[model samples]
Target: MPNTQSRLQVRVIDIHGHRGARGLFPENTLEGYAYALSTGIRTLELDIQLTADDILVATHDFTLSTAQTRNSEGQWLTGTGPESITLTAAELKSYDIGGLKAGSPYGAKFPDQAFLDGVTIPTLEEIMVFCSDYETSSGAGSITLNIEVKSDPTRPGHTDRAEKTVDILLALIEKHAYADKVIIQSFDWAILDFVQDKASHLKRSYLTIAAHNGEHATIYKGSPWLGRTQCLSDDETIPALIKKAGGNNWSSLYKDLDEQAVSEARALGIGLYVWTVNETEDIDRMIDLGVDAIISDYPSRVQRRLMAHQMHWLGDC
Candidate 1:
């Protein structure tokens, strides 16, 4: 690993637009992505779910959420609608996710998000095309795609098998010639393992939250998505687990990371990227930790924080 001390001296933090600037625009919509791009955000962080026809679509939730989505009939869904896996691409596209329900608790969370109408979910291919077109027209470099594969071992049949999901995602990345610009990330470590074996050339990020704690502090005994328990020992740390699984980066909930974890990851040459760090204090904390990247709903906030420290470095695709 390079000298952590030196790395801190010349901080060049990468800013990833979370769900395409969800706080400022409709989450996961094409318009939202466009707005994020306008803010000079080169890394577009998004989630992907497989439609019934096996097409990859950009969405944060596996099921249609009533909080932000409206049905084809233009009525707000009372509860969770059909799962994305059960709907074809065309069927999934009919639902509008442009705006959150007004005055609801969900809408209150993103008070500044522009409320738009008639926005539909964009497919993975569609997003790639948009990025290509935007770069061509604007003369900006290509944007990096941080694609999170949404999967849960506990929720069987809600998503494709890990192997199948990786195969399909890899095919799309190859088809778009995006292997160099894509980072496949997942909370499900099994998919990371599959990618390591199947497409070692592609970059992978291991995502973690504070779900596992206390007795289940170690990933081996804590993470339910790892599938098998024998791949790692109960005493292993998350950074060690990520390295053993062939992940190039460790993406964790900012609060769950400590000085020790950051030092361990840096010592192992694993890049650190913290998620959802929106507030000024949290952004400052992440920067002080010397993380490689910060994924946030407000890229502008991160940019501002970096600017204050004279460490803001605009990244190309």
Candidate 2:
């Protein structure tokens, strides 16, 4: 194991609460986001999908999951029921995603999550409004938003096209004047590329996971989710491809990161942000690696580690 007590001589690594601290709160719900903010997390990492009516909502999955959402009638959604792209915002609001289904495999993963009943998936606009209001009322600084566009090219018709998704999200950011505070990110390189081509002023983060064999293999290829690979070179590392895609930051699966890649990414001027890290040991390891940010399901855990080393980003928060 890496030395847990050794501190890296670098700037404080920002703690990005993944899905608003998914291990403790309902992922992507306003309630969860609020709780994360109360915990002094200034940066929030979330996912966005288009509703059937073309409204953008903060949700991780393209469809409602049986493990975390229940219908308006109060029954758990089963077997990947309706795609968000097929349901209007009003129709999508009919489900309660405030709590996870008990004893389900997905719920089992977040054993410490505090259940909050009657919470619904919130629109991206709603979240932005809430954050703006929170900053005003609490006198805290604005929250940094890392918004991920949830698009999968392999699953045609399941979500909006990459261009449309970026346009909608960019419009929302412009409407709220959040362009300066938000970091647009996605696993889909096409989406990042489009943002680069159009809204070059806004920051973009490229999210990646290691390539898995068979059905999930596109993760490591040029663009697994799309029909044609975009700037994919089998010989290049994920970070290199992200830089080529015009991303300013490289968000990688924490487990897939290594020292050489981290060093190379830094050399390329791409900020390194690792995701979903929860354990203290893993947290320590990431800190030792001198990553720019740690996107974790348990931001409090990261906070404590930072505090122990006197490297907390928010300073005594």
Candidate 3:
């Protein structure tokens, strides 16, 4: 059978909880993931940072971010505080990243998110347990974990090398027995290559962010810019560039996407997943795009929108 994760039956597609629905909950915390599933998101999109000892921990920031996390003493970190690579898994566990100014357009909405003291950064093992148990309790489908191994090939001696990062993540997920339940992704295509090379069974996505090509890049090789880097410019089209840059699978910003683009991508067999959208309108737009899946901060909003829109669509049909 075809992969069920690739599409919806009628209207739209799966909703991936962006860092565990950062706007409604906390970014990249177990609480965030749980709350997102409770609110009806299917996939939990999170980042995995390896510590000094190689424990895979779910968090978005490369450093201990002051805007989103707090120290053991209950003081919120205000800037790029501690580098995650330097801290051990034990020491890293003492910090909590419950409430900060969430992010753009969202920070203004969720004003009173509770700051839970003594909440530690969760290991991949912990998150797996949470999801497995959550499935039993909530009857949700096998929850997908998109763990971006945060390693840069150029920036050595920072996090693990691409190979080691993939190794740590693959081992941890295997220990949890989620080999078929995970999709590993990264902006670092080298890491993607590494993970795909190591574990060919695991679904992999190559992330395309704003690259730094000098002029608005033309067709580098008559393809969208997935691997061939582009200059990060607001003037240029990122999703189109990513399409031209091509890969096995593709992910882009929700705002930069449209229906025609999605269809074009799908015609080429490129699976579409967009990022970090939190509003109902954008959620509606994503459904219209017929995207394979979406990463959003308010998974609840996405679910509600899809459910409601489907009913409306059925009625119209």
Best by the lDDT measure: 1
Clash tally, candidates in order: 0, 1, 17
All candidates in order of TM-score, best leading: 1, 2, 3
Q: Global CA lDDT of candidate 3, please?
A: 0.68
Q: What is the per-residue lDDT of model 3 for residues 1-317, given as tens digits with 9 covering 90 to 100?
A: 12342234445467788888776666778777777777656688888887888788887676776666667777767646888877899888887766664562344566645555556689888899999998888875678888776765445574345568777787887788898888888776656666666787788776654333333323233323223355354555544554444455677656556666676677777788888777777777777777778787677777677667652112111
Better of 1 and 2 by lDDT: 1
Candidate 2 lDDT by residue in tens digits, 203-265: 888777767434554455445553233545555676667666667888888887889989889
Model 2 lowest lDDT segment of ten: 1-10
Off by over 4 Å in 1: 1-10, 158-160, 211-222, 227-235, 315-317
Span of ten consecutive residues with least summed lDDT in model 3: 217-226
**Candidate 2 lDDT (Cα, 0 to 1):** 0.82
User: What TM-score does each of the candidates earn?
Assistant: 0.92, 0.91, 0.80
User: How does model 2 score by TM-score?
Assistant: 0.91
User: What's model 1's TM-score?
Assistant: 0.92
